[model samples]
Target: MPQPHGFRYEELADGAVVITHLERAAGTLRGPRAQQFLAEVVTGDPQLVMARWTGNYKRGNERTARNHPRNRH
Candidate 1:
């Protein structure tokens, strides 16, 4: 485990799923600081993550679903 961690020290576990996905890409990350920071955050929690998740964020189908007519079955 990393000593003196600071990522989620006081935050609620609301966005853990998002965080978990990012850690898997640390190796390809271009910045040393970012990679190191992510490592510190995910060290203790296997389920925790830090994903980039930007490829289709704006055009994803899930977002459109919410705004669609709810009456459709």
Candidate 2:
């Protein structure tokens, strides 16, 4: 069967079909840290993920501001 543009389909050994977005998949995480993060995402609630990311962004901005030399004046 022909796949649609930007999408690909694979049939697993167990006969399950997995359809993926080619563009999106290209940007996804790789390596052990990515695996650990994915495991958390798959097992935890979306709200927790949102909260964690929000806090991370907030702290990142704060760190940037703190390290800016102009802030000393």
What TM-score would each prediction reach against the true structure? 0.23, 0.29
Model 1 CA lDDT for position 48: 37
User: What lDDT score is found at residue 11 in candidate 1?
Assistant: 25
Candidate 1 local Cα displacement, residue 42, angstroms: 4.4
lDDT scores in order: 0.36, 0.43
lDDT of 1 by residue, 1-73 (tens): 2222122222224422222222332222334544564566567442233322223222346557877899346
**Tens digits of per-residue lDDT for model 2 on 1-73?**
1212343333455543333454343222345544554566558653344234223223336668877999866
Residue-pair clashes, model 1: 5
